[model samples]
Target chain A: MVARITFESVHAGQQLPRLDVPITASLIVAGAIATSDFSLVHHDKAHAQAAGTPDIFMNILTSNGLVQRFVHDWAGPGARIKGLKMRLGAPNFPGDAMQLSGTVTAKEVIGQDRIVEVAVSGKNRLGEHVTATVRLALP
Target chain B: MSGTEKNNWLEKVRAMVGREALPPQTAADPVNLPMIRRWCEAMGESDPKYLDGTAAPPAMLFVWTMGHFRAGPGREGGTLLGLDLVEAAGFTSVVATNVEEEYLRELRCGDVLTQRITLDAISEEKKTGLGVGHFVTYRYEFSDQKGEVVGRTLFRVLKFRPPAKTNETAARVDTDTAGVTQPLHPRPAITRDGAFFWEGLNQRKLLVRKCGSCGRLHHPPGPMCPDCNSLEWTTQQCSGRGRIHSFVVVHQPQIPGFQYPLPVALVDLEEGVRIVANLRDIAPGKVRINMPVEVEFVEVGKDFVIPAFRERQAG
Candidate 1:
């Protein structure tokens, strides 16, 4: 197992590892169902097409999840995300891939603890799918 | 619809704002390991913290009190504050536009969640590429078994009238998908409970879940052993030797990533457990029950591998 990333070990401008996420219909639909999003566009291809997409697209909750996973995967366990601010752009449709990459933008020391901020973005074939600023407290 | 009619309809629909979409609904099951495992699997998430600790993935905040769990089966579910009104107004299709959540507390196993949702707002009909429709938002307040507020999420959706069906418009529906290709294989839904199995596979070993208390081996790794219901368990490596118990050939609705007619089999391993895997190196029609097979680890994509079986060679 990789050592858990620590507050002392991280620095500004450090690029977290990249993750190439496969956007499958199963993933899109499973995330919708898992996140309790039952909206037709997140599952039904016909409705998604009618709603101005080529196929069933991902829900915001699922997109949020994939982003969090990206961070947790890099930061290792025991690191807790304080908050996430996200901006959605292109829809994450199935049969595409989202390349998730992040860079540490800033770090703060608060009363003996370290909080790190990362600027993360997911890009697909069309363009940026989702961009987020995630804050986490490292142990 | 006339201006007077639209005005009256909007007033009636807007008047219902702040009304409860449903009675305060409680989660059918408490926060649990199994559901968490399943979620991690679908996400293809491999973090071990979710499995080792009582804390669930924070991303699952909305799952506990989602529509289906609270409504129970055979119940009206996934209702927006003014969904019926919007649908009645000819905005029959819906798509979520955004979601914002504020987590106030950590969610742990055995926490029963109850939530109340009310219509927050419904915007005036606006023209969009999909068609003229309204943007609706809902406010959800969640509480745990102790009545302490745990989280809040705002869900925004566009309830729009679909564009008139045309050959080109129909063709555009799939425009987002026409040029795409399937990757090596769909990721396996491996959770922490089954992480050991996959990790073992990475080492070229076939491991089965063994109950530490009863000394019984079980396939399809689970948190609890069915025989002794023991929470304690270990793993034992198998020789990858098995026999086909039953098999099926899939030929329809071809999903990208695998060849068809694909042959999938349920094999009884010599270690006294049954496992399911894809069959390789043989024609689909040539497979039969009780045929001998051996496990072979095949890497379909970068860092992605699955245990498949091939026909056992003669002794």
Candidate 2:
């Protein structure tokens, strides 16, 4: 019962609204069987294009669970995720539709919790995928 | 392409873990936080207390070593040597450049976590425009349920190529004298609070301790004051100099008896403290960025020694 994304409706370069997400190899083998990560370049695509990876390669624990399900479905449900950092430039194949975006650089409050600081990215259709650093915790 | 298909995928990963050492079946289950908030919203991570853990943010304990799963037998032979070194080198993709972790604790949930992988290193070079690939380095070590050690993961695998065959000639392996550059034999006894900072770095002097309550200056030696835990200190001596805040030429050879390009350095001393040591005399793509350095002291086994850094000589 928590869904709130409203730091005055966010500004500082506002974007957050891309979320395409398609990528499937059975959803990356159900996210490598929910993160036990048997690693084979994330589930062997002929050993991930023979270790030069072109496919099967998005398993930094499902890219941190798709950046915690896009900030818990758009910063809601009592939003409280605090420190996340993503850095894996490319690679999220499967069926590939992937988009996921974000912006609001800083909103601020700190003491009684009301921080924002977003700058996420995860594109597709061949563009600029994977690039993150979200820090929400508003109330 | 012989030797039984190069030991047939490491004997099918040693026949799927056939020398059991007892340590697999780990998933005490607890950290699901909506599957870690749908993997931090597919890594767009809007860290709301790592998706509401009541405010737990310590690098989300690096995703609590990703849940857990360690059933053995060549433990799937390191995933069939990444599918036999990408079907015997025909590379052109594999990316994950840097991911240095070193957290020690703070991973809650049910906390069953237990990993012990050990495919320490694996190498292969030749990149005349990214051609002859291979650079595997896995060394997980996650432990939980009281045993301690909450983290340490170093999984780096590049492998990408497409140009190399003008008459092949880049495979002359076997030459890794551990960390190389040796000399020190019997010299370890810097005891109690790093005995006068190893007697002022064995006389070559470069001491630093200052901390009369957070005045801060410590280097490698600690007994307190990581910013005012202060045991009230004092030592001073650094003139040995510094600079070069970052470096690395380590032609991906993951220490297992190393060799083939190694130039590690992170020096920043002037009593400021940075130390990641090991650079010696030049070469390694020249090295730059504040340059000017000093301090040296090799020597491998036996009494063990380490504190390397060079390049310094201006007015």
- TM-score of chain B taken alone, every candidate: 0.52, 0.21
* Least accurate 10 contiguous residues by lDDT in model 2 chain A: A48-57
Model 2 per-residue lDDT at A8: 67
Instruction: Give the TM-score of chain A, superposed on the true chain A, for all candidates in the order listed.
Output: 0.96, 0.34
What is the DockQ score of candidate 2, to 2 decimals? Answer: 0.10
CAPRI tier of model 2:
incorrect
**The candidate that achieves the highest DockQ relative to the unseen native structure:** 1
Q: What is the C-alpha RMSD of each candidate to the true structure, in Å?
A: 23.5, 22.3
Off by over 4 Å in 2: A1-16, A19-62, A69-98, A101-121, A125-139, B7-114, B117-143, B146-315
User: Residue by residue across B1-315, what tens digits does model 2's lDDT show?
Assistant: 566764665454344432322244244455557655654444445545566754333344445444335644433323423435455545535555434344455465566666665554545443422344656555566677777767665555566564322111111112236722121122333546777766565565667777876677877777887887978788777776788899888875343233448788888887778777668768888888789988876544322346678888755
* Residue pair clashes in candidate 1: none
Residue B97: error of model 2 in Å? Answer: 13
lDDT of 1 at B118: 85
TM-score of each: 0.61, 0.27
